[model samples]
Target: MGIHIIKMPDIGEGIAEVELVEWHVQPGDTVVEDQVLADVMTDKATVQVPSPVDGKVQALGGKVGEVMAVGSELIRLEVDGPGNAAAGAKQKRPVERTETAAQAEDATAPAPVQERGADAHVATPGPAQVPIKGQAGQVQPAQSQPQVQPAAGAGHAAARPAGEKPLASPAVRKRAWDLGIELQYVPGTGGGGQITHNDLDSYLARGAMGSAAAGRAAGYAPRDDEQAVSVIGLRRKIAEKMQESKRRIPHFTYVEEVDVTELDALRARLNAQWGAERGKLTILPLLARAMVLALRDFPQINARYDDEAGVVTRYGAVHLGIAAQTESGLMVPVLRHAETLDLWACAAEIARLADAARAGRAAREELSGSTITLTSLGALGGVVSTPVINHPEVAIVGVNRMVERPVILGGAVVARKMMNLSSSFDHRVVDGMHAAEFIQTIRGYLECPAMLFVE
Candidate 1:
């Protein structure tokens, strides 16, 4: 029985340190070659590092929320066949998961994973959060105690045992400390007949605590202004990136609204036909196809300007990025060659890319090398947004929700589907006319969806 040490590999562009996010397996659990060992966040990306060889986990690195450098020890393993820890030192590894328990868990970036199993205790939830009863976002008080079963869509909280009264809300019981009261003893009047905050205050008024020891038993209450939090993986990365993009770029933004009635109906029909076999044919794929066609008419919009050289280098092929929200932060995976693919092929490929990005199954190759990017905050509609350009790409297109509004066209009042097309381009390279032209061209393709398919 020998051990193999797994180290963090380079998963992003030009990053040295990675914040340790998660460990998918523990000691004695069988893992195949390419199985994800952990998720890590670097300056450029939040990436999943996979196992290099088939093995059993032996040891893992730091607790959740620890920052580790590239080449840092991640996991120690025991292989079934002939291999040793020292032997793994010379092996080349690519992050891939050979064994999967199910679809990968989608958490914002990976959480600092604690050990798993019968003995494994639950890690407390993040701040501004009460401990959810079982998992995320849902908090219900213990059933044994008299507590309210929340109304539909209402947040429910659980009760604490008699002696261990928490100092926070019923929601804070597991994550923080319970709001100091013997929840079990409190009689109920709320739904499902559970006790609420008033009940606890009533208990306290009726002499619940008499000693400083009782206060200590509750939870440590800090000074009002001081919010103590442990900064980890993706959150830390977001802080760093926001600072970088703001400091470096001299940015400019332009926005316009367009008629998208035809485009919307077209995608809806296509989705109805093929969504089950292929993932839903989203608005994003249609937008990508339109952007590619528009880019062809005004080539300058797709070109990058080198400030130092004072030249614009137009890319020959379109490597378009689709900004997607993931477990980590926003990731823009490239839908390479967006110009060549037909609508269905584009939809299928983008679906695969999004699934890969969400599961952390995306290879390093899938993330980089893009000429331009598109982003949509689905259902989050705000008029005219200024998006930051993904460096090296001269521009990024932002899409807002499509809404139907009344319009007087050809002297007739009628309803039409309308959506705003927002673009952020490098002023240093792209002039306002060129950028507007590009948007107008995209608007035309959207207005006439069949015209986009013709060429």
Candidate 2:
């Protein structure tokens, strides 16, 4: 049998880097071309990396749950004879660590242990441990570990041997410091019993992670130079897109107040009867319906610029992207054909999309192809914030808090239902004047519910 090394396959997206989430087949296991070998995590989805050559699995790189860059070696195979590349026997397999480089990138990383906050000599956690093939490692849960107390709180720290090193990561050490937990007090369960994030989490959950830290390390002082931190996750993505929108698109913002008292009453009436289904009714559906109708009157917001084709693409139907606030990041899932759906249908779709986003189950298709977007911060008691336009299709609307306020009607001060509608459009295609008109168009529907019935 000739040795055939099976490098990582290009998944056709040409995108570099995928996270190694799981390994299905182990080395020495027989696999066929096209058999599923491992599952990889991309930015948008988790895809399975299949075998390209038929044979026995030879060498495998990296451990499961580690994020590996694309073009990196995933697995190697030993083929009996070269045959089909597209077809193979389906191979299902076991879980274990494969071979690796003798030296990892984080080699020499000292594990942090608290020896009365003395000199620490801990190696980097298991993720960056001795690299070897078929290494038998255990995922020792932190729960079994003793609570680690830090210098600030390690008043009774057990002395460590001069040559013995503690096991903990920099981040874990930082966390222990913050909580006054002395790592010296906490026994690690990592390979050679090292401290991991999970161990720290376990310690914290048990309320024994840390106590009073002695204080800041002696001779520690802040420097004049300040570190500028970049946002991460949802905030980072949001800031990048917002900055790009402001720089690329000439933005036009429009603000108007919608009198939603009648709509509110209708919602309350329906919710009372809906009970379980009534839980589905939110202000979002009504707002979506209003926006859909407004788009019908002012079609510019639903249009995209085709710079190369020299023709603007004005959409005949609305594909509304609902912005959901999730823990990891902001996800905007599109609801295609928003105009054709009724208010109830819109509410159901919004709930489904939001749930999918929250659960991290949002499909790639659910996130793309949005003609326009709706953002709701009303739940946070916010009012009248300008929303940056989501580019390409240049418009996004924001819903503010709903509250009762006195209004002057024909010189008569009376209470009127009030909610702010703030929308920003692309000045390139949707001019400021037209944008304001569009907001007013939505106001027209929100104020007069009869228009919805007629349309």
Candidate 3:
């Protein structure tokens, strides 16, 4: 067998490094050509690394969450015939130390001494050691182990005398304490009468600890489990972007209530009429049209701000950003040339871009270069929100949920479908008065739905 090495490829945009997000294959896993071996993150997008040649994975260069530089070794594989790597070259990969592996031997050790009827037997605790896999793929015990006390349920002793401390590892003790379990009264089943994790589980499972335990058996068990998820990939990118936006820009938010009763009615009528010939329309397309028309009077809102250069660019063409929530995280996909598209066309493009973003299939160009962003939580949109401006963009308009509420219209209590527009702007570029005027303009078009089609 020959050795093959796969190095991290440079994922364009002059990026010097990428964070290792996920691994599709591990050592001993057989991978076929064109199969994705790993996923690495560059900025916000995830790029998959596919295997070029069919081979068995020998070793991984780095663990997940490790930021690897370009051209660094990613994975090592063994294939037939002479591979690209030298036959006798030593592969240098970081060894991973897992919590389970550190406690593996302790979990497997023999139980402690016990008294049987009239006779008593003494069981000695073995030396603490951890097993580590050697380069030769052999298991070797490492010397000078970290100090470890026996875990819970250590001994098979039927009963221990009162005031005698129960033998359990620190982890087990902490877990028991969290569960309000008194270890002294509990029996140990581990080596030398030590308490183990299993003993605690079995104890809880059997409902041995009276009323509170019985309540747990009846479905009120208190849990102390925690998961440590590393912030990487798209989530990391979002955090950084949000932090930068908040830190670098002075932000001001404006909110206005709009009577969208006519707008909703118009939408329903359009769907009813075009139900068979064209796709159904959502409230988004109308809003997009309104914003597009409104930008004519308020050019400052449809622009990008270069804070470092002290330049506020005003765009004649409306490039709208549709904020979408994906399985990975929040992503904003750009809807280019919004000024040119009508309501139906805008709806189609919005749906397409949202689908592409959610599926992680959106191209880089489709994700960037938005002049202004429109975000909505749809049915979940609450009464009010303080949206943050998309970095370098002067404004972001947020759509909130619409609800029917009683309103006094010409001395009559009329039920009106009212919605709120929550928008944010970079205070450094767009003034607060202009931001308010911008939202009011959209409101006028929305309340008077026919004006959306006005030339």
Q: Which parts of model 1 are misplaced by more than 4 Å?
A: 1-17, 24-37, 41-231, 268-280, 305-311
Question: What tens digits encode model 1's per-residue C-alpha lDDT throughout 152-203?
Answer: 3222333444333323333423222233333344445556555455665665
Q: What C-alpha lDDT values do all the predictions have?
A: 0.65, 0.66, 0.78
Pitting candidate 1 against candidate 3, the one with the higher TM-score is 3
Ranking by TM-score: 3, 1, 2
lDDT of 2 by residue, 232-349 (tens): 3344446667787687777767778888888888777778888476465887888788888888877777887654466668898899989888875677889999988887888889
**2 versus 3: better lDDT goes to:** 3
Provide the TM-score for each candidate, comma-separated.
0.63, 0.61, 0.78
Off by over 4 Å in 3: 90-92, 95-222
lDDT tens string, model 3, 1-455? 89999999988889999998887876778999999999888774778999999999888888776789999999988999899999678776643434334465453242222222212211222233334332212234444222223234433332456434468776676566546565655678999899888988887676655553434331343432222345767888889899999999888889999999999999999999995677889999999999999999999889998878888899999999999999878999999999999878899999999999999888877889999999999999999999888898989999999999999999999999999999988888788888888899999999999999879
Output candidate 3 Cα RMSD: 9.2
Q: Estimate the lDDT of model 3.
A: 0.78
What is the C-alpha local distance difference test score of candidate 2?
Answer: 0.66
Model 1, TM vs. native: 0.63
Q: Give the Å shift of residue 387 in candidate 2.
A: 2.2
